[model samples]
Target: MLIVSTIGVFIAQGVQWRNHLQRIESRGKLIVAVRESEGIFWANGQEFIGFEKDLIAELERELDMPIQVFAVRDLDDLYGALAAGAVDMALSGTSFGTHDVIASRPYAMTRIGLVHPKTRNIADNPDLESVRTGLLDPLGHQDATKLIDNPPQASAVYDAGRISAELFTLVEMQDLDQVLVDERDFQLQQSVFPDLQFSALDLPARPISVLFNPREDGTLLTQIDEALELFDGSGLLGQMTDRYFGDALEFDYVDNLTFEKHLTARLPTYLSKFKFYADLQGLDWRLLAAQAYQESHLRANARSPTGVRGLMMITLDTAKEMGITDRLDPDQSIKAGARYITTLKNRVPADIPEPDRTWFALASYNVGAGHVEDARKITEKLGDDPDRWIDVRKHLPKLALKDYYPWTRYGYARGAEPVVYVANIRRFYNRIKKEYPQLDEAAEPERLEQLPDIDVPVFPGL
Candidate 1:
C-alpha cells in the first residue's frame, strides 16, 4: 500500500509538471523571480532596462505570454520559490549549485576585466608591453599578457587588503602599473578612479542560462532553446551585446582623468544652474553636465575655434534666440543649452525609441538634424537598420567622404566629429552617473522585501 501510494504521487506530479506552459498561460503572466534589482535586471524610471529584460521580453513574445517580474530578498531563496512553485522560473547569471534544477541552453558568456594606470596616451589600442610594465596579474592568467612582445615583470604588491580599489589607488599614484580583478569589482572602482584605463581579459568564460525546477516539463525548456536560436540566427544577439556593455567603447585615459578632476574643481560653482535648468527641461542633470564637459570642460570663458563660447559652448545666434545677450555668460549659456538639446530631442522622429532618440538629438546638436538624416540615408543605402543608433553611427563617416558627401543635401560636413562626439559624451555621462548616482530623483520604485512563500507538497526535486 505504501509503495503504491508513493508511485501514485510521483505520477501525479509528472502529469501536472508537464503542464508548466499551460499553468503560465492560464495565469495571464509568467511570474519571474530575480536575486536583486541590478545588473541582469533593473528599473530605470518607469521603464525596465538591461540585457536580461531584453531576454525576458523575447521569451514573452515567443511563448505568447506576459511576464510580471519580482525580486527575492536573497538569491538563495530562488530555489525555494521554484520548489514551492511561487515563480515559474528564475533568471540568473549563475546557477546556485544544485542538481534539483535544470538550466536552459546557455545564452551569454561573461568576461573579467583588466585595469592599469594611464602612463601615456593610447591613441587606439595601447602597446601592452608599456601599459603592463609593472602590473601584478592577480588570477595569474598569463595568456592575455602574452600580447606584449616582452612579458611585463610582476610588480610589488601593496598589501592594502584584497579590494580592487586599494590596488587601483596605488596605480593612481603611479606606484604600480596595472592589475587584473573581477569585472564587478573593476566596474565599482571606476567612479573613484576614472583616471585608470580598463580592458577585458581575453579569457575563456562560462555560459549563463536561466533555470527551472527539473520536475517541470521538457516542452518549456525546448521552447526557450528555440527562442534563443531566433536571436542567435538573426545576429540580433550580437548587436544587443554591443549596446549593453561599457567595454564596447574605446578607453581614453587622459580624457577620463580630466573629467574626474574637473568634477571636484569646477562643477560645484555652477551646479545649481545645471540642476535647475536640467529639471526644467526634464533631463538628467548628469547628461547636461556631460555635454557641457565635452563642449568646454566646464570653463566659463571657453571659446571654440568656430566662435562658440561659455561652459555650454552656445553659438552667437543660439544665444540671441534664447533671449540672452552674452553667449559667454555661464548662467544664460547653461540654461539655453539644456533647452536647445531638449528641443532637438523633441524634433527627432517620434517613432524612434529613447535613449536612441536622445542620442540622435545629441548628434543633431553636433552636426545638424539634416546631416543626421543624411547619415541615416547612408546607413539604409548600405543595407543596415537605420532606426538603430549602432547601425546609423557606423555609416556617419560617409557624410564627410568625397564619394558620399556630394550626394548628400547637407554637402561636406565633418561627419566623423559627431560620431566621436556622441561616443565621448556617453562615456562622460556614465562616469558622472557612477560618481554621483541617483542624487535627486525621489520616485524610484521600491523592491519587494519578501514575496509570499507558497507551499506545494507533492512536487519532487528542487
Candidate 2:
C-alpha cells in the first residue's frame, strides 16, 4: 500500500507539470524574471537589450512563442518569485539551490574577485575585514560562508538596488575603498575605470543559468536544455558574447595610457565643439570625440598625406560639400564631418536596425557608400542577409580581392580598413562614454536633409 501511494504521488506530480506548461502555452507569453544589470539586461533606446535579453529572444524563437521579462529588484526578490511560480524562469546572475531546482546547463560564468581603486594596493589572500570591504550582493549566496573570511553581512553590502558598475564609480571617486566583485561585472566597468586594480580570490567560477521550481516532472526543463544546446552549438552564443564583452577582453596597457593622457590633457579644449555639432545632428558627442581622436589624436592642426585635414581629417572635396572653407578650424571641421556622417547614414536602408545601421554608416564613412552597397550585393549573392553588419562585413573584405571586385560596380577598394576603423571607434566610444558619465546626449534634434538616425564619421584615410 505504501509503494502504491508513492506511485500515485508521482502521477499527481506529472499531471501538475503538464497543467503548468499548458497554461504557459495558452497564455502565449513565457514570463521571465530578471535582475537588470549591465551585461545581464538593460534598456537600449525604447527597446531593451543585453546577453540575457538576447537569450530570451532565442528561447522565444526555439519554443515558438513570446517571452515577457519581469524585472525583480534583487536576488531575494528574484528567488521568491521563482519559488512561487510567479515567473516561468529567471535569467540573471548565478542562482544557487537544490539540484532538482536548478537547470542542468550553464549559459554563462562569472569569477569572484577583490576590486579596489588604484590608490590602495592589496596583497594576495588578505583578510576581508582588514580593508574597507563591500559585497556584490547584500544577501549572500549558498556557499558564501565557505568562500570568504566572513559571510557578507547585510549592513556591509552597498545598496542592493545599485548595480555593480555604479559601485565601481564610487570606488573611483575615493568614496568607497574596496568591494567584492564579479569579474564579468568589472570587465564592463574596466572601460570606465582603467586605473582600478583587480585580484581574483581563490574560488571557482560561478555558472549562470536559468532556475526552475523543484518538481518530479522535467518537461519544461527538457525544452530549456534542448534550446540551450542548439543555441550553444550554432555559434550564436559566441556572437552574443562578443557583442557584450569582446571589447574589454583584449586589454592593452599602452593604448589605455594614450587614451587616458588625451582624455585628461586635450579633451577639455574641444569638448563643447563636439557636443554642439553632435547635438545639431542627433549624434552622441562622446562618439564624435572618439572619431576625432581616431582621425588625428585630438590635434586641431592634424593633417594627412592624402590631404585630409583638421580634427576630423575631412577630405578637400567632402569639406567643400559641407561648406567648410577652413578645414583647419576645429569647429568648422567638426560640423562638416557631422553632416557628412548623417549623409552616409541616410544612404543606408531604413529597414535595418541600429547599432548595425550605425555600424554600416561608419563603414560607409571609411569607404564610400557605393562600395558598401557593392559589398551588400556580394552578401546577397553569397546567400547571406545583407541587412546584418556581421554578414555584410565578412563580404566587404572580399571587395579588395582581385577575383571578387571585378564583378562589382565600385571595383577594388580597401575593404579591410572599414572593419578595423569601425572597431576602433566602438572601443574608444565605450571608454569615453564611461569616463564621462556626466555628459548627457542631447534630445531629438533637427534632422539633416530629412535624414534618419546616424553614427559619427570615419575619415577616408583609414
Which candidate has the highest lDDT of all? 2
- Residue 327 CA displacement from its true place in model 1, Å: 0.8
Tens-digit lDDT track of model 1 for 1-462:
999999899898885542666655655667776544334555555565667777888888878887777754344465566666667777753322234677787777655545765554322444434443332232122344344324354333424223345577767776656665435445434655766766665556645578777677765678788888888777667666655554335546666667778988998888889999999999999899999999999999998798999988888878877778887888899889998999899988899987788789999999988999999999989998788787888889888789999999888888888888888887777677656667344333323334444423223343
**Poorest lDDT segment (10 consecutive residues) of candidate 2:** 453-462
Question: For each candidate, what TM-score against the reference?
Answer: 0.74, 0.73
Clashes of each: 0, 0
TM-score of 1: 0.74
Tens digit of per-residue lDDT, candidate 2, span 1-462? 999999899998884433555666766667777777766776544455678878888899899988767765466666655665656677656434233355648777777676786767544425434445556664434344235445343124546667777778777776666667678778776766777877777777777777776541456678898888888776567667766776676555578789889989999999999999999999889888998888888999998898999999999999889998999999999999899888888889999877778889889888989999999999999988788776788889998999899999989999999887777777888788656654234222121222211211111111
lDDT, each prediction: 0.69, 0.73
| Candidate of highest TM-score | 1
